[model samples]
Target: MRCRGLSTLAAVLLLAGGVPARAAGPLLVNGNGDPLVWGVNPIPFNPDRGTLGTLDNAAAVQAVLDDFGVWAAVPTANISFTNAGALPVDVTVANYLSYLGVCGDGLSPIIFDTDGSITDDAFGPGASNDILGFASPECGSFVPPQIAEGVAVLNGKWIDGVDSPSNPEIPLADFKGVFVHEFGHYVNLDHSQINLVEGFDDDPSNDDAVATMFPFLATGTSTPHLDDQVAVSTLYPAASFASGFGTITGTIFRADGVTPFQGAYVIARQVGDPRLTAVGYASGARYFPSNTGGPPAPALRGLYEIPGLPAGSYTVEIEPVSHFFTDGSSVGPLDPPAALPGLPEFYNGANEAGTNPPDDPTQSVSLVVTAGATLGGINVVINGFPPAADDCSAATVISTVPFTAGFDASAATSVASDPLQSCTFGGPNQNGHSAWFTFTAPADMTLRADTTGSGYDTVLTADTGSCGALTEIACNDDSSGLQSSLTFALGAGQTVVLEVASYNAGASDVLLFHLAPVLP
Candidate 1:
């Protein structure tokens, strides 16, 4: 039977004021007493299982799960339909919770029905409790199921009518992809780990092809990307809960040849079977771009310190700020260096390094940070232009120039270039560029920028993207006009680009970009 009144809980909570402030401690998991769960059978027109609909059945679900190496027996239930028109939010929410293992009298499962009210279709307790549900009509809007606090809600309409002519069934693989994503939320996976992708490595330009949990929704081909598996296994390891693993500490700095980068994210992931990769706080942490917490290292001037790591070998990544341009104009206050020909109307020009494109790492080094030992000398350097001639005017000209051809990160003479262009930029001139780099994404990232030339109007900007259109994420154009920095999200395979240019034309020798990855 379709449940009523349950769908309104989410609205009531919103009306009563959203999530209450949470005090610091280990993040709470599945603490909610009233858990909601949802269920669906693929018989849209037929009320009996004999005429079961065309959508993927339990066998299909099991096959997809097997692809990810997760084995579970599908449960059978005699789900009765009351010709209730549509499922209710209460039922959807309850079902959603049950799928994630989040119901009971302290653990009893709470079931609700979707009465098909478009407005009241979806239900949830917001980011705090991590439980929610929605009707089939609403489910069409989101590809994957979502969760909060161990809840599993489904769109019964979509599930039943998955094979409808107007709305054909989504691929079984895609269905599994959605389930995996929603289950991620049940365990508190934040929208991709922002800091880890943005600020930790040298090149913040390349996209992470292996990140399963990247923010993009599934299209029915369910397969966990490397990052996705890393995230899930890390937060909810196979082993039972235990405490007191040793910690590892280290700093990530710019390469020896370039200026120190700040506010970049640094991440460390175990190298081995995807299922065994370390995650959460154990995967890696972040340090801010400004290094406000402390001083740079003696050898590496812009050093970042990361702490609390389980002992293991890890891949490291660094990225710039995570922002994108939308309207083809300026992103924040930073102006374009020069409008390129035939540019799009709305573009993102925040991350336009002469050499290093967003997601492109200037350096990559393998090191082991012991469970309790502090490691040092992990320096990443960007190539800088050599000194100009002695003439004062020449010096001014050289200093004011935004970038030197010699310093481009793509100019690396040592390594073979990947056929894929690393970074890109957006702004008035479509000249905005992107770079690609590979690194381990820790839990957080920081970004920082500096201006070396005498120009008074230089500014810094940044953006982020997974596989689709880039979005404006963050930017900083300090009124002082010399330096700026910020920290933001980083998804695996996600690219972050930074743009350094004059606020106004006529200013030259104006910009410098520095990235540093801090671990905690």
Candidate 2:
């Protein structure tokens, strides 16, 4: 993740675990191809879970209701929730599991884990770090999977002022937002990625730019984003939604054009007002039957559809999901999102989109969409630009010392590097658009390898031995402003592999690397 400033940073953390993908769709749909929603309108919930940490029971109940109201207030969505009072018996951590019976009970229960005991009992130790709250479908059908009943839990330790040495308090105001975020999942809405710079930049002041259903929780995003509103509206659209909004359908392809690129993010930005954009779609957003032991649906990978778009002229673009948004913090349909070897490009009016070498961002065509009309065949073919040394096995060989080399990482692809490598503070340890080089030491000496003239922020790592069996020797980030330099000793005949990578995703620059022996 990118960090612009330390003082401005907001509390941000990982969210729920991965869910199986079905045709790349964002909604949690049933076998019948419908989003699993409350069959009955005005979903009822038991919010009386007693006092939650420092917050009173009434405050906790009101907070949950306020979160539900955030979704219910969407003008385009026809969904609501009502308080069904308390459960028959007080649900302590010991008895909460028994209340979570299979099938619909009509009463959704909310639990307050004051001491995080419930989280430890439910998910195991240290779960509170990533889990502020979670919602699960307790009662549902498989044939046409519908959520007849559900339960939600909030980690009260997050708001309780008493800070534990293990789990510190996550600002009370920010903790309140988790309820809103978890509720989005309760209503079957999946994660959406939009204005992703906020998530990647580590600037929580602009958290409102992200969707509430975003895979991670960021401070200030308590309210839902336009994408979140659209998601809920699409699932339970009001009468005017279908007639007042438009849809765009397209396919994302590799440079080959034949191969589809699943998990690519597609955004439809309104021509003049970019804020009025329609996003939150991964290519191929449909549910497949194979996941439920039924025959698979027709191939829909790389396909994408963005609905709830108001009639307007918009420009569409495609890029890979942020690498940071993975695993427990995954976005779209694919967990641990795919690192597509495609340049970020805008959709130009090309007869053969992806086949072209360069999809220039400056050259784009504005497409006018009509309300209720489904615009099809907006296929975008991404130009492949994987760097020659994208992998460690293909490391560029450096024959001599006191060497300087040039690199263009604009369209480079990032590969997995050793996790144990030490990176300095002030930047993410992970490398983006990484390129590798191998050097065989001719003599015993101490040498300094640095990206002294890199146009963008760079991180450098050096390791000994082969790619599979290697020991990290040195790693540095921001040794110099927006550049990296590290010194290490190499024995005669020993080899070292060096990795130079961008500090942030999609960050590119013409780089100049210098390697020279250090003299005492």
Candidate 3:
């Protein structure tokens, strides 16, 4: 069923699919250019015979159907949905696995984990806050071998349901929101951390967030938004898909005009509509070399293409990839800076803090995209100098309340070799530069230091006192992924020193830290 007469952008975006026929940007992720869909299968659910009304078979089934309807209503997509009733589970593997008939029947099942036993066990009991509901990808083109489908598990034990589909009205975990988020993955849609909380505490449960596909299920997940709609539509485009959208492609460069700049993020925001944001990365992966002919050395390069944008005027903005990207927002490969290579700037260096170039991307001289047309040559040159604001040595440790520091540089600003501890406080064996910091642990708590996604290989060190008589409390190479991590036991009210240095003279990278009460 196709929407032969799609109307306004709102009509096309919000109401299009909800009706019988219709239409679709943010980013239409890198799927193999193939139509990745789950077909119109009965979205089955196993209530686990729970007493909660929300978990009852009928209500649970309807909930899944309603949410599926919300997505199927998209007029421009060929994706369809139907209820498969409850999955037959007379006897099977583990309780959760039983609900997920991957072993018995080849179908995706949504499990309502009534007892904490299954959900907690799957996530390792104590470590579930970082998770709520999850979609299992059995197949697809995934980086961590993802963007596929297998099974979905919802922590029914914790979900306090809010009946209305138009909900998640508060910050509490809403059932509808979780289903929508998981379904997005069921359709091969990945997470978009576009709604990153302004500062170091990269929480994404923003009530005002625009995408249902955000990494952390935000309040906005109850309903689809511009970002979600465009991405889904692009993947499963319907009839007449090309008549309503266009594409924007370009390259990101350093001042030298020859070096490719990788990891920089790009977006085409619709003029006057702050919510209409289309994101793309100036990436070296799956793209060509820079315009000046030099490769994005040290694995740094930038090239982008944003497709499925409604024909309209848009401001193309370029900015530095904030450290929060690795803190939790960004998925797949780590994108932390190896060096604070440059400050964020607009395309063509317009409206630079000091310069008043009339053609700043944010102004009237914006890029105009025509339906089905590809707009190229929208190149941007990032300011190559590292700003002091981004330098670790130039930072002030505010409190021991837990924070983050990034060292996207070549060498440690300064380091020490302590004789007081078995291992010297010496950091990173690699020509890897470093960043410095200090914090006062207000109370007795465990300190967790990490370099999960710092671009280059990493080595982190923690000490107290002066450089001459340092206490090498913690030091590590690799514990998580290609990054480094360390869990330090510290008492409250103690002053602790921290270091973020790369392993083996690595490239610009990022680091993360956390503090919590020692678990009994």
Candidate 4:
């Protein structure tokens, strides 16, 4: 798991698979739950003599200094750092751990491991394989915890690409990006999910929009996004910071309208230019076993506030955290993240209960934000409606050939299927968000069905007969990559049931199910 700086002063951030004991918010907090910040400005840091593989000592040191400049350059944030030159002695694998957690002694060191030895020593064996780097706060106080000092470590193997040639050797620019991000944590900033799209790291197109503190490093740039700027400004605001940006506050609720919903991503996107945005999780997001237990009262659990938004008309929406971004790569508060019970929707003042239509993005309403103002009561109650094709009884009908449609199984529930006895399409005990679709043959023909363009591993199955009593005709798995494909024969006027399911639980995104006639 990530080492997010939290409220407790002495709290330590353990690496992957370890329990995430600390809590997080827009800003890191102290023991008394006050926001944490450096009581002094121009924080001084000492660097070691080790090189980042190809980058010599001078180049590596300059990279760290330059990245610190990027954060100091934020016009609204009163944050600055100075390079205090080399450490008293080079901290290598021999005695690096001793230098860690040494706070209030006026030493904040940045150690560089030319190889994976130091990294493995600190985190464990094979840690350097995946972890880029990490930062931690060595607290000096607990009440209204103020950061006296901190420490950070960078693994050079990512840049050297020696251990694993297949591992993407980080570009110098992206390396600086990682420096800025780790420094963000060093200065007591937790991970923030803004302008988030699942699986965004592999696709560089979304690079410019990602936040510096986003859990995973996308196209790493030295520059911090608006979300990062606001977070820093919230802790170390300049005189003009407040007057320069506006705030939006609200509460998110379940269909019952009484129970608050936490862990939902709340985003405010500029109406005309969607590139400009800000995001936050609901108030109780950091609490484990979400929505019920937290330091905050039940009434305040789902409250969210987005600050540092420029004056403009903007639309707001809520979506579930991506299922892939859990555990070590977790986003927001809940580790092993939770998905929203309903579909992603906007704040249009309509909530789904029994009869109300499901909330839609197209129906979103815009609100005007002004400088130095806090707009409150912009509440939203998400629709409780499940996907239309969730059950066989509500199966969506397809009449023509070569048909393809998008389906989201994130909110779809598993149906009754004896996979071991009836079929092995998805293996025994496979999680079935099995969405249903129907097709009738115009004439007897062989048809091929496949989930070729799906985002996650899928299982495709064909069945004959009604929902209650059905026999599996054909099922396929891993026909191409992790996608599934199958072919079936049918007579004229015959109808077949198509069930699209996943091998992994809580899979979403467009399930591209393609069906076409096979000409012989």
Candidate 5:
């Protein structure tokens, strides 16, 4: 578990008591095994930095104790935490650098940044003052590594509530919520994405998620949500955890019925309470297929597992990551919808995905699960095409010239951090979340592909032939002020593939995929 930086500013007051989040998506725990033991140093590592809403020594330390109690109360988890007493401050060390040494030393020290010194080291100097706290873990490998120790870092700018109520910058409740979140990382849980409208709206129109593991939570929440419990139990399951829970294993398919749909999101919601949902992804596959071993298979790529579920009647819901992409740092809505396209559906045996409207629960399939039994073959199919092309194989069938479409890079993964097709206009590897579009020559023609007025830095690439065997035609890094553009010639009946990506990885930009004919 590495240190997770705050997604948005620290001022976010995301809490709504006792309401479990709908998406308890896991980041594939970084530890080798489960049941990590954490001991928080009850002392303040750094003196107050004197910011607007900093928590004092007594209040800060107490918050950690109270927050740890939240997780300690989970019945199914074998995890237990201890207040390890005050940590000895390093006299030789002047700033937050001293606390950095504690992460790998097998000591989980809950530290407070008296000033912005620690944050400056974590992000950079003069960064935003919004981040309240962070958790650092020892990640040996890229995916699911052994977590050695976790060090929690809190911003000392504002002495938050319960410490000093008069200084009303950040309430004590908010700080406590932040502590529980970072602590989730401390114990080996990772971030998850749930769709909810942020800012001034207490009620979300889409899906309102309020889990400790969610990137951002609603304000006034204190306890661990149901999804969080499922994750913790899976990580550190007790004796009854096994007998009390069941597992769901399944695969996802494309409209063609062959291509393995990899990145789609699948959830099993309790028939009794839809909000009590457990989520996983059909992710065993990568976007790019390899020819070395053999061709791709559905079982090899499209697989999902939702374990530690309570034995009950449940309904399965499937949705694409196109609208809500999980980036490295945060998870939330993708850049405004760009015909990203994937019909969300309940597993009712048919393909046209649909959700059981929030009011109606019996509208979908009610899957029965017995404790310790794995229900398999609950397959799903996604048929609708994205407004833009999905890949060279299923490129959007386009006929109109100067066509406009949308692109989202939140779900993008870096196959190659560098440019794969061209170098001249190649920008950053933002191409990780690349989108595809293809067109056949109306009659020998030249066309220009442009992503202008895009919110983020954009890049474009052109190719010919199948995705596995692509012939790069042209590539551009930046041409229209942080946007991307390129021109290529297309012969009659020749299908040219166009790719749109961000200049930086994980950046979702709202823009048009404009393909206009090049006039002499």
Candidate 6:
């Protein structure tokens, strides 16, 4: 979340170079196989600057890999030593090996030790590598240390200072988000082309900005933007298991009768059985957007190509940058709101409002793909969902909500402010929306939802399957109570349903929903 300051400015001015030539294809290493994948075992600083929780942090990191289907094996090298006297050379080598599945070929997914030193090295030059986190000429761009075959050494200093679950400098909950970005690079993802035009310079522009593999460091606030997931999935498709893969293509439009919303994110996910096999996982399966191009130009109709998918059923969901405002008004550009509290001032232009949140209570559409078939014309019609006057006065409100595979409103333990809430949503009453949303699940998956809000008493639910003979996941009638998280198991070829129902019925409120791959 920190910038390079005058030093970076001087470097850019001195170079005066145009944007680097965009690679036409995947970055090649040694002209042989895919790019050499690597990993980091962040070294810790003496008297660690922040808190450390091994299990939760590891879970967070694993979640990132699981989402992208990145094949990361258990670490092979020994990286237990943490003394400052010992350089992080071994630690880096070991971590990279782990990512390569050197330790065990069939490892589901693993999270290595997030040493403090590694975290620092990721952000900037510390006792180890000189690369700066989220800055141009990053550590990975430099000559990576060489230790073993097919392994590259990663400096932890930059990452140490940047923030992670292993480091207490920032919120531990966000360690997975930052690691997701770094891991994207480990799998050969580069800075988004959009960052170049945004004048982000050497450092990342926004902490909470979306993009699974965004170039920025962790702010413990940002969620994976639509582009982020699409890129990753494009590189790896979940449906690759069946004989031949299928393709789903589509355009996104505003359901509110506005112009087509360019730069929006369209994600297609397999509905049933959130659990994905480890094999063929890292090859860019279930997740996309991050591994592809950067954010599209404003008003520019962008074409999305999702390839390398296994033939099966899928639900495609399109989410645009959505922001919330107190009064009903047009959502502004992606820039940070000029006026807001506890929010930074910067805009990346990815906003979704009006239609549905990732967890909206409604099932939009469905698609069935046969092996080797390229399905097209899967268009999305986004419906704007602004908050009601009474709903705006509620005690708890969420500005931006990340799209998770399984979202249970009753199980929502806490309500955090949407980091992307710019003035565009038009005050409290106005909010963002999603184009038509779709999700694919196994035929036998069970879905459920509930409504719980003090000021607002309604909840929306939707999906591809009918809610006939379904069980109630959870219920909280007390307005003062917090929302609970929902849990459901979906099977392949099954559809989930979403609909809206009022809990208290004092005032009608709107909820948004989108679909994403559920990590096993």
Best by TM-score: 4
Q: For each candidate, give its TM-score against the true structure.
A: 0.36, 0.71, 0.60, 0.72, 0.58, 0.34
Clashing pairs in 4: 1-15, 1-16, 7-29
For 349-468, candidate 3 gives per-residue lDDT tens digits of 343332233333334337788887889867666554432122334444646233433323543343334222222226324233555566776556566666554566656677777645
lDDT of 2 at 72: 92
Best-to-worst order by lDDT is 2, 4, 5, 3, 6, 1
RMSD of 2: 11.5
Model 5 spans with C-alpha error above 4 angstroms: 1-54, 90-94, 101-104, 125-128, 139-145, 158-168, 195-209, 277-301, 322-328, 331-341, 350-364, 386-520
lDDT of 1 by residue, 1-520 (tens): 0111111112111101112111000111111211111223211210111111243334333432343233111111122111222212223333443322322212211122222222133332232111122111111101122121123232223334444433223343444544454333333332233223221233214223223233333232144443444334333333311121222333332333344443333344555631224332211122111222223234232343333445666545433322221111111111122111110111112322223443133334445545546555443333234222212112122111111121222221111211121122223322212222212233343433333322344344455543233344655545343544544455544445444433332233323343434221
lDDT of 6 by residue, 115-208 (tens): 4344243333342222222211111211121111111122222334554322223333444444444444333343332221111222234433
lDDT of 4 by residue, 141-170 (tens): 433346677777887777884534334356
RMSD of 6: 17.6
The ten-residue window of minimal lDDT in model 3 covers 3-12
| Alpha carbon lDDT of each predicted model | 0.29, 0.68, 0.48, 0.66, 0.53, 0.30
What is the TM-score (0 to 1) of candidate 6? 0.34
C-alpha RMSD for every candidate: 16.9, 11.5, 11.1, 9.7, 14.1, 17.6
Best by lDDT: 2
lDDT of 2 by residue, 161-231 (tens): 87655665677777767788777766667666687655544545666676666665666667777788888
Candidate 1 global lDDT: 0.29
lDDT accuracy of residue 194 in candidate 1: 28
Q: Ranking under TM-score, best-scoring first?
A: 4, 2, 3, 5, 1, 6
Model 2 lDDT-worst window of ten: 5-14
Clashes of each: 142, 4, 41, 3, 26, 148
- Candidate 5 lDDT over 140-213, as tens digits, reads 22222234455666665444333322222344555566778777765646554332222112333322345566
In angstroms, give how far residue 320 of model 4 lies from its true place.
1.5
